[model samples]
Target chain A: MLNEKIICAGFGGQGVMLMGQLISYAGMLEGKEVSWLPSYGPEMRGGTANCSVMVSERPIGSPVISDDATTAIIMNLPSLDKFEVDVATGGNIIINSSLIERKTKRDDLKAYYVPANDIAVELGNARVANMIMLGAYLELTKVVSVESVMTALKKIFGESKAHLMKINEDALAKGSESIKAQ
Target chain B: MAKVLMKGNEAIGAAAIKAGCRYFFGYPITPQNELPEYMSREMPKVGGVFLQAESEIAAINMVYGAAGAGARVMTSSSSPGIALKQEGITYIAGAELPCVIVNIVRGGPGLGGIQPSQSDYNQVTRGGGNGDYKLLVYAPANLQEMVDLMQEAFDAADFYRNPVMMVGDGMIGQMMEPIEFKDSVSRFDLPEKDWATTGTKGQRKPNIINSLALDPAELEKHNHKLQKKYDAMKENEVRYETYNMENAEVVIVAYGTTSRIVRNAINDLKEQSINVGLIRPITLWPFPEKAFDEVPAACKSLLSVEMSMGQMVDDIKIASNGRWPVSFYGRVGGMIPTPEAVMGKVKELIGGEK
Candidate 1:
């Protein structure tokens, strides 16, 4: 019985929406009911962007994560500032320590500070930072496999952008190792 | 085809194209902009025409033009844009043209913020245009239902030779969910387009497409005839769903995105030993008035939940016919009511009882 309400947030260019989409797409591949809702309108243009991703075994009802009952994948400082309190007291918060300096303000949460940006830069592409954060999230929760995510990535990027897959995979590996090493 | 992950706005375009609607005209608007954008990209692949008109009014009139020519056509917009097209919508309705109008609703009294809101309920259901007219409206709850209804809307429009509306909030337009396009099963016996102005080649009488009647009594007769189609739609096209409806204490009535939220509330309440039933209307117009008859006499009361300030409450009250004292719970101006908020409302109403 897998039901995870995930809020993935960061600056607009940080691929936050893509992270949410990948989780949802991977969940669907694993035969789970999933939904992804992106934050649209004015804020999405080089501003803070976020998305709510829900993966469940049963039929999904509301696509909203109003109570923030499950997990938070925060990539930037403002994202952490905004969504840190939104995560449930006993829930999980996977922070990108590369961009965000502060720790979780609440002590009850299981927080993992992964250097997603640093890892992505080391992998030679800062854009894959989101996948690093996603890797950390998957490692922390095991909601969906990194393999399913790779399949989702291939399908999303299609055959046109096939060249970028290697870096993304490396970022996902580094992200997973970041949390496991802790 | 297997289920694919697609956004709600993109799904609308795909569904319309699947339904044999080859012509689309729409203006750019937030939340719903993806719909037109998708059409622009995909319509050409299917040998369809996607035209971004200069304005929303222009787009709807183009729909009217294409519909009068007997072509399956569609146009879409958000709240403020939908308002701009009301006059053309009325013209299409008065002419008895078959076209689909999709309003991916945004919060508004005027040019309001682009967020999910069902504030267009009254504007859509109560005839936003002038005169006595009704557009067959479908309010789909999820991405799957959204595509399903988009396909059905074209059929309904042609079947009744009237404009059919598919209204979903920004939630339905912005969310991405797994969806498989199903073969459409139309509920109406589609009549021929004999009344279309397709240039008869002098083979018969010219079919004049006009909504004008200078004679007072003549226009009255036309209005009366149009009323029959609306009545037939009520008789044949009503769609709704019920969940946990048997002998429940608090019965809820909701539709579209709000209905999904209510479902969560019902499931949560069931764990606490509170029996809650839900009646979700798929068709906003025709009102699903008969669904209220299914409520058990053992039920305590009815609650109408919406993303608006209770526009649908009037219809629920009329449908319930004073059988139960109906109370309304709502969050307006782009604020979506959460399941917890709805639970509190239901418990409040339940607490007052007994």
Candidate 2:
């Protein structure tokens, strides 16, 4: 853990919360202190959803508030509208360009708009857009290694989803490669 | 040696595992649902038992059952749900069964708002259930203490042969905090037991954990024994924190989250040249009256701030012994008073007319 707090947000069913959990789980796998907190209650249904994942080398005091977020992942316009202001100065924002039309306007912050949905679709799974976005985050933020993320994916999906793991991995590679291009 | 950032609920769940607790029974309630949800997934991995009971009542009873088995058993709930567990809690105490209960308190007189509140201080410290029984209540202020106290609660429960409670408000449960687990302080060396109802095949006799002493004499003796435990707890376990009180004129007494808020109030009071300090009770039941006794002669009054309508204020008054005038300020339900709001009261007491 390196005191990195990422707030992942998007509309419901976009796997916004799942993306956050994966990052948290990955941090945990790396023996880092990590917390994942999802927005609560009925708002989880058809409303905008957000989850906060904080990874630190030290013990975290509060998972919810961070003026030091090193990275943020926004899947849609609603997410960008909601959390773009809170991204720390100099933090990176990984945006899904397919949905969020307006760009982040911060001079101090770095923004990369990846067509995550398009890439996920090209990989034959729109649901994996969250993974692609996470891949973009991992690449741009260098929060975790691709190998570590693959290990986490294996643990999370387990032996049963072994087949779908390849496509997800491919999508993640594409996202990473795109970030390298940028 | 490694640290993991985790929700307060998740931290407690993980701590329970580290503490050698193998049985968990609980019902889901706001601000604390993550505890059970995390246990549901993690318990199986550790070969532990996690059951989502039908309600708070049943959850506590399941705790009773597992505790009687002489295994480390635990349960958790929010305010209203904890209220429902009161009856079973009393029974657990009366039976002297060792177990740990966690109250991730939310604001409530009824189905209060899901936001965190320290309103449950009195109920937890004074025995949330009925009877003369007492719980070794450990009130943790942050996530690190949350994990540490969970382990303490289990050890204390077994040590005293009574139920112990870990009391924390919504903030401690929901806040993300950095915490570390040390192997030295993490594991337990609890006594080996033949009291568990594992199997009767080669057992000397069946062990039954029951509070129903049909004979009046036996019941009275049992009650007396429990009283001795409570008395001993009062003497040995009262926990508190005193801040900037060497020459303080006003003593602000608070507990749990309210105490943290009062710390801010004290800072603001100091900036105005008001000599004020704080005495925060970390263990609400064994209310740390000892610290209050050390209040400087210049202290003319004590203030009690809570999230409930002065529930803890009543205790402060009793502890003060009418020495200094005790005052009360509070916010009810799920509404937490801002530090500014508490400062207003502090100013009125310390700066304005007493």
Candidate 3:
């Protein structure tokens, strides 16, 4: 793909912004042009928080993604409710089945559901749910390689948090594997 | 130089340091808070001064003092905060002091939402402060350009001995993108600050840096000198870019983030067999009037896209000089116009051209 516009959205504490940043950083690692823009407002934690991530062979134009999202990774019920229609025709939608009880009603695009929070809890860190969703998105799209994401994580966390790399890698593997089995 | 991903605000802060700017004074505001935060941490490490002033008024005066002392200085604020600094900016300009001011603009008529907006176009381009002064304004469209222009802003300030404004909106301040810093340091041959107020040291006559002149004739002379410099800047510093204008039927004029959206619109219009082009002004003050002269002869109409209520369209019309019909499309109050909307507007303007 020459370009991909993805919206990662959930409640504030779900690491929606971090997931977007990871995707952007991974795109940078692969020597592609990337942009990550987080929605900023008066909302605090547990409120609706989302970020727009764009990876392209050419430089990104607008960081604000009102619509025309090539992929939508929604982690909660509200996010799925909000952004399901924004997905472009024939685009892909990934839903976190652990928190979202409803399914996307659109028939034009592919939909994949992962119990991301449950999978992260299984990996002993529920905070990594966004990482799980990121892995699933990567597996489905192959926009950036998993190896690039790993390198990006190392750069992000650095030496002080090096010990947590294993669990993140495991979470990524489990998420990608679950999608493959489906 | 290695490319690293950085937020636009943080990259500008780092670029200022790279350009040898060691004195930063500013009051904090939303959407641009990261700039001051980055300067707070980085300035002290470089033996530089970073003061969080009591207010934007006090901050700009501090810049005046530092710049008068021959120090490369900078101050940044958002919309309302920048409004408070206008008086001081006018004073600095009158004194012919070199300083860099950054305005990461947010929506405004008053304390508008902290989201990005290009509504400050008129305020910055036409002197926001009182008097007949001009600030060399640069509007960068992306992170790399932001970094490059932040460095160039300091050079331009010193080269002209005037305040240079780097105008960007909230999206440019908040978005993260990869940027590569220039390998070589800036090499502009700036005039020596022999007239700087550095206590005189009893070796020569004491230098006085004041904008106040009791005699109107003297003030007029000073204003005329400033006007001459501004004319020279208009001739030498106008910057812009043209995209796909070779055989375009409609031309879109925009700058900063709005230009990016226009580029996307151009791409989509091309796919539909609509030959559209873009003229992106990089310098708001110099305004790039010459770019309109280069608009293809095949172009039938001109369209200006902005995040403001068509502030730049007037300039586009003036530049095009009625050679073609001019149209404008804009969204204000922190709302960003989408590519589809811009393309729709372009199609409307160039009816049946496809």
Docking class for model 3 is high
Instruction: Kindly list the per-residue Cα lDDT of model 3 for residues A8-83, writing each as its tens digit.
Output: 9999999888889889999998889899998888897699999999999987877778768999999999999899
* Clashing residue pairs in candidate 3 (N, C-alpha, C atoms within 3 angstroms): none
Give the poorly placed runs of model 3, Cα more than 4 Å off: B185-187
Instruction: Name the 10 consecutive residues with the lowest summed lDDT in model 3 chain B.
Output: B182-191
Query: Clash pairs of candidate 1?
Result: none
Error at B249, model 3, angstroms: 1.3
Cα error of candidate 1 at position A28, Å: 0.7
Ranking by TM-score: 1, 3, 2
- List model 2 lDDT by residue over B295-320, tens digit each: 88778678888878878777887788
Q: Is candidate 1 or candidate 2 better by TM-score?
A: 1
lDDT of 1 at A149: 97
Q: What tens-digit string does per-residue lDDT give for candidate 3 at B127-187? A: 8898889999999999898888777789889988999999989999999999899866665
The digit string of per-residue lDDT tens for model 1 on B195-226 reads 99999898999999898999999999999999
lDDT, model 2, position B246: 76
